[model samples]
Target chain A: MLKFNPRNYLKVTNGAVLLRAEIEKKMDEVSKKEFKNLFLIGSGGSIAIMYPFEYIWNSTSSIPAYAEIASEFMLQSHKQFDENSVVILSSLSGTTEETVEAAQYCKERGATTIGLVGEMDTPLANIVDYPIANYAENDYAADSINLQMYMIIFRLMHNNGEFAQYEQFVSELEKMPENLISVKEQTEEKAKEFADKYKDEDYHMLIGSGTAWGRTYAYSMCVLEEMQWIRTKSVHAAEFFHGTIELVERDTSIILLKGEDATRPLAERVERFAEKYTDKLTIFDTQDYTLDGISPEFRQYFPPLVLGSLLQRVSVHLENKRNHSLDKRRYYRTVAY
Target chain B: MLKFNPRNYLKVTNGAVLLRAEIEKKMDEVSKKEFKNLFLIGSGGSIAIMYPFEYIWNSTSSIPAYAEIASEFMLQSHKQFDENSVVILSSLSGTTEETVEAAQYCKERGATTIGLVGEMDTPLANIVDYPIANYAENDYAADSINLQMYMIIFRLMHNNGEFAQYEQFVSELEKMPENLISVKEQTEEKAKEFADKYKDEDYHMLIGSGTAWGRTYAYSMCVLEEMQWIRTKSVHAAEFFHGTIELVERDTSIILLKGEDATRPLAERVERFAEKYTDKLTIFDTQDYTLDGISPEFRQYFPPLVLGSLLQRVSVHLENKRNHSLDKRRYYRTVAY
Candidate 1:
């Protein structure tokens, strides 16, 4: 009777939505400044959410944008910072040690720091100069606010549509919460099916390429690694083509994230690759027109974001099916220097 | 009948050795400032071989290093370079479009460049400012030469170390060619044992961590993917604790590169992990008692390069068993921005 209950995760997901909306409003209202660059600090899911924003922002602004998993930069060279730099710090529970240390380092070096999180009362929220609360209270994979906040940031970035139309998109986002609930249900059902079949799989390899490739990085390290205690590895699909693809044979259950963007073709290729080995290929296509003409907002960003949320639910569900409790001790552990 | 032949690979291996020796001598003569940072660039095996050198150099001198496959970097950010960088480009065939473009990009940007290759007159060798020929005419995994050149570079990094001891190591290296012939026989036998059990495996997962992790990265990408055309994935062992390890099943094959280094202990942990799912596990330990007694070259600088060569040999032998020809082409279509 190991049914997956995402009650704890749901509350944080709700909080993250609120926090992200607030931060987007704040960033938008601020006086526009001519700046040389934008720097972001957050690793794992927190930073990954920034990718869509970075991609959108880089297209519009002349300012150069750079980011590193806060822990990764700390390992190598240390660059001096100043007040003019715009720095964003994000964490779901708001307690990742690396994010906190990076925040402190940036603050000490006089960088204008903005913190985003699902938790309102955590030390990270208290210490950061500009704290935007996603309002999450507990630590659970289902409660991850990374995507919720990321969607808001991406929506805001779309405000300056160098790529496509935005008015309809913004209006659609206003209705996303209700629409998202339905998507979540479908995702949960699919996850349940997957968990039933693959629950005993002791090692999992999640592979994707391009922007989604980084998704593998975080999922392997954060979700599958942290929550499930499963042996997992994520790699870019093209890199996968380099040598590892040779090991693919029947019996390898692979999950491929089919990004609806330019990376869609690569996903398709990987799906074909998996077929060569076995039929146990899970290909997530974000463009299924099942809802066909759904709200304008739901159509644009909801595809991948909805899929991502579902994948999160699936991972947790799989963990539950295995009869393992979610462990968040590492989440609370002091971010190692 | 299509049979895997080592004759072509052997010729390339010889060429790689001479090419590596030339690069070694050239590096010794190059001005220190010109060699500011050792930028190792290539795809697959070339990139894999340089990991040990990067690890070793970073061991002593705080001289910074960056190692990346040319194709991956070219797809995204290319602005991380400046005029003062020293680019060390490696390609077994003196082809590989990405390395060629990277070398060209470096030359155009006023960076001193060096080429390590299997052929003297190949396009890659012609494009670089200093091209060192390994004399490896055939591009089939530049086996012996890859390690030989790496050892020379490792020695060069320790030029400031005790010369008397360095000379002794050189004497040992002179003996290494013969040593490798024996090691080749040993690894060949081991590869046969592994292939007998797992060559028909539909899925294989290889795991390593930290410095040694690069070999797994390279092997999974180059040897396993390119040569075997099998679905393979490599992962950091530390990350296994996070989540993906759950994919391991009674059917999946797991290979652990249990080298005798700090990360060796990590192999045992991974072994325990593999046992949780199935008893199908293999550990390859570089039982180098002599390596321990030798003057400690920085792990970062030495291990990957040394281990890379050894691993390349193993991979080539495995490819031989898999009945795949190692004729490399299609270098990810690299073009300069």
Candidate 2:
């Protein structure tokens, strides 16, 4: 477990889990209001994190949800966004220019705004109507934000009468901090092996579907390209056959983030194809890990959290094996654009 | 212009324009009916083509529009898609398996389904409630599909009382074929230069925003990766700063698709950054072309069409300069997955 701190991870994740009461109260208030639609806005990893919730909300609830990039959302002048709309935005630093500006934009439009941040009293937190803060480092922020999102979003769905199993789901979620630690422990060895094996691989294709798609996208752009400086293409399983599948060669690295959702079959299709075409196919299926005290029915909702925790292990190993600082950046925040 | 076919382009684009009367008749019926939302469903390039319309719809109309991948849409069982949903699908060959299945899925749910195809009696055309066919070759397919999309989508917005200048817009659209020809003619030399310059580049970063985003994604994946076996990372200009920008270096090839839209500033920001960071920066701005008979006020809506026509020239030059056939594929339709 290179650079891994289990105790700190638990502390950050527990902090997020402990926000359940406050998140519940805020979600209850917003859910009681009549909103036409929900806009989930953020930048980069933040926006990628919202994709799973958007997919979940669209599939399970009558309320429509849109996951939009903060800058694009600000400029689009979306006709669907109005006073009756609810906007949820996140920025771990709470100082991300685009997210903060988007929060201000939503406030000006008289929409209900919720902010998720790693610290309190930041620009984003100050502008949002409901600001939920938790302390977490970069390695554990995904687990923290995702944990809080599960509490807020599912509660909203419960209030909408779309999810009757909320109590059971949250009960299972409460056990995740401990279970996710075990997931990291189990994945550590494999992550190390993967990093050791593919440290110098120039390009890779990461494919996923359903809830896992966000993790696939974020891990490629935010981690592989941005963190490790490795080239990668993150394509949805359904989109693989369309164009990207043609890029597959015998030695091409293909990483499949498989989760237990309705779209699992789509990922399986890609796995079948990749197995035939490439020798460097890697499948990170959440089904291989057993979360103690979690129901099988709830596994569908656990991919984002589970995959996040597992990938954190992979990130640490990649940094160790590649001898590249995960925090190193060539231009981002280094120079003014 | 290399590989240019003016007569065939006019015939295909005019066919789409001719469909306006029938498209209006069908859209009038759908608009008169009570509908909850619009679902723009397709696979790969089909879904990519729907993105601009989705953006336009969200910006101009109160009606919420979703652009969903066909296979994932079927599996997700999106709650936003119901009997009151107007589902639009396209499959050029009218035989994309996922798209046909999606049309069936929507039909079984009693949703209004519209299919745009190259043939009238194919599976997708036969299954959809309203099928609009306009024969086109690969080079002109984008033009044909985008032309019909402008007509149908704008008419839908007009019916929703969101577009007051639909007549003038359509009139301008009628002049697009000839104007688009001029765009190709003007861009021919630059396209050839770009192809000759970057024909051997292993990878490229294609950045675009707003209406040009879809073209960026499609060109990178569908043309570069699939057709030329050249790796590419197509990122939205807004999202470029988030993660992908870190990958840009002095010799890194960056293609900027600049379109006139609310998000034009986002592209400009990327342009400024790439100018300073990379010497291999190529800009294909629709503003460079004088679209005769098109009002300045209407130029914003023409980027997708204009970019599509302009890129067709790039495709022809790339094929010629690289000595690679655009239709040749290693996997796509060449082998069974």
Best candidate according to lDDT: 2
* CAPRI class assigned to model 1: incorrect
Residue B336 in model 2: shift from native, Å?
1.1
lDDT of 1 at A71: 47
Worst 10 residues of 1 chain B by lDDT: B328-337
Model 2 Cα lDDT, one tens digit per residue, A1-337: 6687889989999899988889888999998787889999988899889999999999898988999999998899999899999999988989988889999999999999999999988999999999999999988888999999999889999999999999888888889999999999999999999999999998989999999999999999999999988988888899888888888899999999999999999999999999899999998999999999999998999999999989988998889888999999998778878
For residue A170, model 2's alpha carbon misses the true position, in angstroms, by 1.1
In terms of lDDT, model 1 sits at 0.58
**Interface RMSD for each predicted structure:** 7.2, 0.8
For each candidate, report its DockQ versus the true two-chain complex: 0.18, 0.86
Question: What is the DockQ (computed on Cα atoms) for candidate 2?
Answer: 0.86
| Cα RMSD to the true fold for all candidates | 8.0, 1.0
User: For each candidate, what TM-score against the reference?
Assistant: 0.65, 0.99
lDDT of 1 by residue, B207-301 (tens): 87545777777777666666666566576665454334545567768877755454455567788767666678877665552343334542333
Question: Given candidate 2, what's the lDDT at residue A220?
Answer: 92
Name the lDDT value of residue A39 in candidate 1: 70
